[model samples]
Target: MGIVLNQSLKNTIITYIGFGIGGISTIFLFPYILGKTFYGLSNYILSCANVIMPLFAIGMQNTLVKFYSQCKTDEEESRFLSFTVLFPLLLSVPLILIGLLFFDDIAYFLTKKNAIVKDFIWLIPFIGLCMAYFEIFYAWARVHMHSVFGNFIKEVGLRFVSLLGLLAIYFKWITIVEFIYFTAVIYFLAFLVTMLYAFRIKKPVFQFVIPSNVKEILIYTFYIILSGSVANLLLDGDKIMLNQYMAIGNIAFYSVATYIALVISVPSRAMHQIVYPITAKLMHNNQHDELNDLYKKTSINLQIVGGFVMLCIFVNIEQLYEMIPKEYSGGILVVFMIGISKYFDLILGNNNAIIFNTKYYRAVLFLGVLLVLLTVGLNMIFIPIYGILGSAFATLLSITLYSLAKLMFVVKRLHLYPFTAQTLYSIALTIVLFLLFYFWQFPFHPIIAIGLKSILVTISYVYLNYKLVISKEINQVIDNVLKKLKIG
Candidate 1:
């Protein structure tokens, strides 16, 4: 718990800083500098790449996390690691070949409604390849219980790189088209840095030979591919699908709102960096009681953090949108819709890590595939009728359903649940705070208004939680902060 707490704290700071940088780039820089259409085009390309990343990596990232702990010796571990690396290339190479073979057909379909996407169609696979390897190597770092550097690379480094790219476009050092191409270059370089860093951490002695669990590993990887695809489809599929159903610019509008809402999940993302591999190790060692304790603590703590973030976003949404350009204002509803899903996702804690690391993973994979179909189908129907708002609705519905399914599966199979009376208390507290502060406004600039309102919300929210003692873990964190500040 000490290590988890310490590393999660560091990760939380790093992730928020990354999100801060990302928020500036996504919310202000890109849209203002590049214009909405080009911004949407950029988002669409990245979303497309993300949606396909699971397939290209062939689930090696997750497989490495799950299996790496089980190896009997360093030699066996190295062999397992080596296999995870080379195995994905087997799928990625063929994917590249097929993309080339039918490049024109693929581009036509993708760009039918938004032809701006046509020119950048080829960048998707290349960027996806970069994203895939970064995850794989990041997992490589995670398995070694060395996640901070990788998390920094992932959360801070990549966003910082994208920031540089946006600054380049802003300065006229690169044309918009060139920036798009250079974006792919940025990701590739980041991947190389992470991969090299991972090697420095645990220099992979490339053993091309298979580990003894080759059959089981390959089978699990196959299912993970579908599972990973399902996860990404739920996350990024809407942005890609929007390009088909609406103008490319709508994607930009949706991206801003979603990005704002996404800040709620930052704590969970930060915490998961350390918690995931720990969860994997716990399950591997059959530490059920410890695992259950972790599951509950993570849930409550994340709910507290994510709920506060959602509260801030919802309460200040009007003022926040005011800070953005007028064209992007249409996504306010999108923000609410997606924000709820992300908050729910946070409260589930490391449910995905739990499921993926367990033998019951295959069942969840089947469920995930169906949900993916449901997601795509809902998006197709809703995007046409509701546009980006419809995409938001579809995403909210699918992710809620998916999270519910995973929660139930974990409970039913493992007999572990993440809920408690405090969970209910926390939810009720969040609602009260939101209702109390949401309409309270200042007669000032949006920034000042948001700042003052956020302070009020934070004070009230933290005080109530402190009084109620909703989470011992979180309370301890607060106590530590106060101690550091020498405050009562």
Candidate 2:
């Protein structure tokens, strides 16, 4: 718990900083500098890459986490690591070859509704390759319990580079087209840096020896690929569907609103970096009681943190939209729909980590595939009728159903639940605060209004949570911070 807290705190700070940079880039630079059309194009390319990333990596990232702790000796560990590194090439090469062989047909299909995607179609797999390897090496670091450096590169370094790319476009150093190409290069650089850092953590002693559980490993990896694809598809599939059904520019609008909503999930993302491997280790050792304890703590603590974020975003959403261009303001509903879904996901804590490490993962993967199909069908039905709002609706519905299914599966199968009395209290607190502050606004500039409102909300939210003692861990964190400030 100490190490989880320590690193999760650092990762939270780093993730917020990255999201801060990304927020600026998304809210200010991207809309103003890149313009809506090219911005959508950029997002579309990345979304496509993300959607296909699992297929390329072949789930080695998650496999490494689930299986790494089982290695009995450093020799076995090295062999397992070697397999994680090299095994993806077996699939990636063939996939890339197939992509090339069918490139023309693929390009035509994707570009039928939005031709702007045609020219950058090649970057999808290229960037997906970079993203795939980055995650693999990132898992390499996570399994070694060295997640902070990798997290920084992932959360901050990449966004900072993209910020620079935007600045380059601003300064006439690169065309938008060149910036698009540079985006792929940025991912490649991130992959390179992560691989090096992972090596620095534990210099890879490459061995070709497959683990004794090769059959088990392969089966896990295969199911994970489907699960991973399902996850990515849920995250970015809306944008990809938007590209198919509407103008490319609509994605930029949707992206901005979704990015705001995305900030609510930052705590979960930060915590998951470390918690995942920890969760894997716990399940591997058959530590059921300890695992259930972790499940409860993670859920409540993340709810407190993520709920605060959601409250701020939801209460201040109107002003935040005011800061962006009016053309993008229609996504206000998109923000609400997506924000609720993300917050719902946040409260589930390490549910995903728990599921992925279990034997029933294959069953869950099948459920996920069915949900993906449902999502696509929903998008096809709703997008044509409701536009980006419809896409958001589809996402919200699918994600809610999927989350409920996962939660039920975990509880019914493992007999572990993530919620307790504190969970109910935390939800009530969030609702009370949201209702109290939402209708009120500072009569000032959008920046000042947001700042003042956020301050008030933060103070109220923290004080109430502290008084309620909704989570002992969270209360302790508050105590430590106050002690450091000599104000407790």
Question: What root-mean-square deviation over C-alphas does model 2 reach?
Answer: 1.0
Distance (Å) between predicted and true CA of 219, model 1? 1.3
Worst 10 residues of 2 by lDDT: 479-488
Number of colliding residue pairs in model 1: 0
* Candidate 2 C-alpha lDDT tens digits along 305-391: 999999999999999999899999999999999999999999999999999999998888899999999999999999999999999
Q: On a 0 to 100 scale, what is the lDDT of residue 346 in model 2?
A: 92
Across residues 249-332, which tens digit of lDDT does each residue of candidate 1 receive?
999999998899889999998888889889999998899999999999999999998998899889999998887899888999
lDDT of the structure predicted as candidate 2: 0.94
lDDT agreement with native, every candidate:
0.91, 0.94
